[model samples]
Every structure is written in C-alpha cells, then in structure tokens.
Target chain A: MIQFKQATKRYGPTLALDNITITLPENKIIGLFGPNGAGKSTLLKAAAGLVRLSSGNVTVAGKAPRQMRAHLAYLPEQNTLPFAWTIKRAAEFYRAFFADWDEDRYQKQLVMLNLREDMKFGHISKGQLAKARLLLTLARQAHCLLLDEPFSGIDIIARGEITRALVYDYSEGQQTMIISTHEIDEIENLVEHVVFIDSGRAAVFGDADELRCQEGKSIVTIMKEAFRHGSEQVEHV
Target chain B: MDFDATRPIYLQIIDLHKRALMTGELKPRDKILSQRDFAQRYNVNPNTVQRAYREMEALGLVETLRGQGTFIAATEEMLDTMKQDMARSILDSFVQEMKILGFSLQQALELAQEAWQEEESRL
Candidate 1:
C-alpha cells in the first residue's frame, strides 16, 4: 500500500500538490485522474521517488519510496530514453540494469506490441515510441508499476494496444499498478479504483464501481460533475 | 462486454452469464472461463470478475469444484426461476417506459403484443 500522509509538494512558488492525504491500496489497478498540471505527475513522481516532497511524506509498503526503488518501475510521461538507441539496445540496457527484468516477457511483449527490435527510438512513429516505452516498462517484474499518461497524444490504435498490454500483463493480487491519465473514459472499465485530483487536491477517491453505484453515473460523468460544480458536491472517499 | 456506466459492472457480468445460460449457450454442466481469463477477455479488473463469480455462486447459477473450475450449476428449476426473474425485470422496465410515454395499461399491452408479433415475423 502507498500512503501519502498529508503529502505536499511545491515547485518554487507553485503548490503542485496540496495537503493531499490518501492511501492507495495494493494489488489493484488504480486510476490517478486529473486535468493537466493538476499534480498527477508530481504525485506519481513522488511515489516513484523521482520528486521530493516539500512537506509531509509518501511511503510505499510502510517504507520510504527511495528504499523501495528496486520494487518500483516508473514510466515517465515523455520518452526519456536515448533517441539514438534501437529498441533492442534499450531492452539490453534494461536487462543489464534491473535484476528483476524479465527477458521472456520482454520478447513476448515486443512481438505483442508489433514493435521491431531493429527500430531506432528516434526513427519510429509516435505510436511505436509509446509502445516501445510501455514494452520496456512492463517487461520488469516490479511490484508497483507507475505509469504517467500512458495514453496521451497517441492514436486510438496505439491506445488500444497499450490498454491490451496492460490488461495482458496484469496479474491479479500480485502487482500494484497506478496509471495516471486525464482521459478517464478510455480507462473507465479498466481501473478498479479512482482518485480524482484537481488543482493538486484529491477531489474524490473511491472504488470505481462503488462511486458509480453511489452517484448513479459513470466515472467520467462523476468527474465532469465534480469538476463542473467545483468540489463542493464531492465527498472525499 | 460493453458495460453501463451507472450500474455496478460485476452485476452486469453476472447478467451476461445469466443471459448465456438462458439462451442455451451455457448448459447445466458447461464449464465457464476462469476469472483471470474472463477478466482478460472482457478487458476488466480481475477483482471485478472475482466479485461477479462470487455473486454467481451465491445465486446458485454456477459452482466451483476443488482443483477444477467454475461450471454452470443451474438446474431446470433454477433456470426457470432465472428466466422468470430476468424476463420480469425486462418487462417491468418496458412497462415503465410505456407508462412514461403516457400509454394506458390496455394500450401498452396491445402495443407490446403488436411489437412482439412484428419481432417474431422478422425472425
């Protein structure tokens, strides 16, 4: 379980994450949802130990994130990989780096994602780049997988492929996945829980089906209503 | 496996299986897909599928054997009860819709009969 005890982050004068206190459960596919610049990335970065919290603390499985780095695999929003390296080269790099990296899963996902081993990172299309990044990230046997905007700026087909890969790779009750995205409808059915963050505050957080059942609306619709009328109507879960 | 956003998805999964049983697509002893496979097939959370399977078991619609897997457990009597229950719910909504359209009971029944005959003729 990942617990953010009154977690707060600041970048100079901007408050990226405001006193956000929430406990994300383990072994479930969680949706970290919000609009652009709503501290979704910051929250994910904090969990991945990439960003330091200005105040409060974030812990993974009752330990600091940095201590749990080996068990966490983080996929940033942008492609941070070397542009000159081929997909095969990147796989080799990951294989040499992470002890838990699964080559068998990598080979299978490489084919499943329709990505050629010889394709250079810079030369491939946007869709392929997204697939390549996802392929590498999922190949790791990490306990907690943090994906930031996995579907952003990609075509519908690529988005579908990514979703398929996530579902295919997901093993119930063994892995914890936190997927952050603004596109709620795309993953409405894919996630078991949702945390709606707006302006760096957790507006609403609850089980997806329970929220749907309680509000008599879809998660997308609930988000729309929550953000449309401010956070007054929302009762934090 | 498209789901209604407003309702619980687990309930919908149960309804889908019940529908298959009603339509004879699933028989009394037919084995169903494992929860993991069902989740992957439907592109949904496995926990949701597990909940659906538990609900099905509670309803006596399916049973899981040790070291084996889940199978359709509805007997003839259970199937009859299921059919009546499902048909009643559908009919309730249809009647409610007709009433909202300002149709009287007699008129609604007549229109329903006509619609049923039209559907049968098409089939």
Candidate 2:
C-alpha cells in the first residue's frame, strides 16, 4: 500500500501537490485522472522516489519510497532510453540492473507487442517505442508499478494493443499498478479504483463501481464533473 | 463486452452470466472460468469479476468448491425462477417506457406483440 500523508510539493512558488492525502491499496489497478499540470506526474514521481516532497511524506508498504525503490517500476511519460541502443541492449541492461527482471516475460511481451529485439530506439516508429518502454517496465516483477501516460501519442490500434498487453500481463492480486493517463475511457473497466486530482488536490477518490453506482455515470463523466465544479472532494474512504 | 456506463459494472457482469444461463449457453454443473481468467478475457479488473462471482454465489447461480473451481449450481427450478425474474424486470422497464411515451396498457401490449412478431420474422 502507498500512503501519502498530507503530501505537498512546491517548485519555487507553484504548488504542484497541495496537501494531498491518499492511501492507495495494494494489488489493485488504480487510475489517476486529471487535467494537464494537475500534478499527476508529480504524484507518480513522488511514489517512484524521483521527486522529493517539500512537506509531509509518501510511503510504500510502510516504508519510505526511496527504500522501496527496488520493488518499484516507474515508466515516465517520455522515453528516457538512449536513442542509439537497440531493444535487445536495453533489455540486457535492465536484466543486469534489476534482480526482479524476468527475461521470459520480456521475450513474450516483445512478440505480443509486435516489437523486435533488433529494433533501435531511434529507428522504430513512435508507437513501437512506446510499446518497447511498456514492455521493459512490465518485464520487472515489481511489487508496485507506476505508469505515467502509457498511451500518450500512440495511435488507436497501438493503444488497443497496449491495453490488451496490460490485461494479459497483469499479476493478479500481487502487483499494485498506478496508471496516470488522460485516456479515462480506455481504462474504465480495467481500473478497480480511481483518484481524480485537480489543482493538486484529490477532488474525488473511491471504488470505480461505487462511484459509478452513486453518480450513475462513467469515470470519464465523473472526472469532468469533478474538475468542472472545482474540487468538491467526494471521497469514499 | 460493452457495458452500460450508468450502472455498476459488476452488476452488468452478473447480468451477462445470468443471460447466458437463461439461453443455455451455461448449463447446470458446468465449470465457469476462474475470476482471474475471466477478468483477463473481458479486460476487466479481477476484483470486479470476484465481486460478480460472490453475488452469483449468493443468488445460488454458481458454487465454488475448495481446491476446485466455480460451477453453475442453478437447478431447473432455480433456472425457472431466474427466467421469470428477468422477464418480469424487462417487461417492467418496457411498460414504464411505454407509459412515458403516453401509451395505454392495451396499446402497449399490442405494440409489444407486433414488435415481437416482427423480430421473430427478421430472425
């Protein structure tokens, strides 16, 4: 479980995360939804230990994020891999770096995503690069997986394939996945829980089904209403 | 499976299974997919599938055996009850819609009969 206790982050004068307090349960797929610059990436980065919280603290499984770094797999929005390196080279580097790296799963996902080991990061299409990044991230048997905009800039067919890969490769009841994306409709059914952050605050957070049942609306609709109304803060727990 | 965004997804999942049972696609004593497998197949969360299975168990529509798997536990009597319950709900909504459309009971029944026949001929 990841718990943020009145977390706050500031970049000079801007408040990226404003007193955010949320406890994300373990082994559940969580959808992080918000408008651009709503601190979605900052929240994810805090969980991944890439960003330091100016106030309060964020912990994973009762420990600090930095201490749990080995058990966490974070996929940033943009590609961070070297352009000259081939997929095979990146895979080898990851395998050597992370002890939890599963080469078998990596190989399987490579074929499933229609990616080749010999494809260079610079030579592959944008969709293929996205898939390759996702493949590498998912290859790790991390306890907590943080994905930021996994479907950004990808085509519809590629997005479908990425969604399929997520469903097929999900570790049931053992892995906690926090996916931050603008594509709420694509993951409406896939996410068990949802957190809508607006103005760096959790405007709404609850079980997806319960939220749907209460509002009689889809996640996307709920998100739109939440942001439109300006953070009414409908929290289930 | 296309889901209605207005309702709870787990309830929809349960309704889908019930419809399959009514159509004989799922028979009594037939094994059902595991929650994880069903989740993966439908691209839904496993927790949602688990909730649907629990609800089905409460309704006596399915049973889970330890070390084994879930199976259709509905007997003929249970199936009859389910069919009647489903038909009544569908008819209730149909009648409510017709009423909202300013149709009298007699006219609504006649329209429903005509629509049923038209559908049968199309099939």
Of the candidates shown, which would achieve the greatest TM-score relative to the real structure? 1
**Candidate 2 DockQ category?**
medium
Return model 2's CA RMSD, one decimal: 2.6
Work out the TM-score per prediction. Answer: 0.91, 0.90
* lDDT by residue for model 1 (A152-178), tens: 899999988888888888877899999
Off by over 4 Å in 2: A232-237, B34-36, B63-70, B91-123
lDDT tens string, model 1, B49-75? Answer: 888999999989999998799999999
- Candidate DockQ values, in order, are 0.69, 0.61
lDDT of each: 0.90, 0.91
What lDDT tens digits, residue by residue, belong to model 2 across residues B1-123?
Answer: 788877888899998988899999999999999887897778787767877999999999999999799999999999999889889998899988999999999998898899999999999
For candidate 2, the lDDT comes to 0.91
Best by DockQ: 1
TM-score of chain A of 1: 0.98
Q: After superposition, how far is residue A78 of candidate 1 from its true place, in Å?
A: 1.6
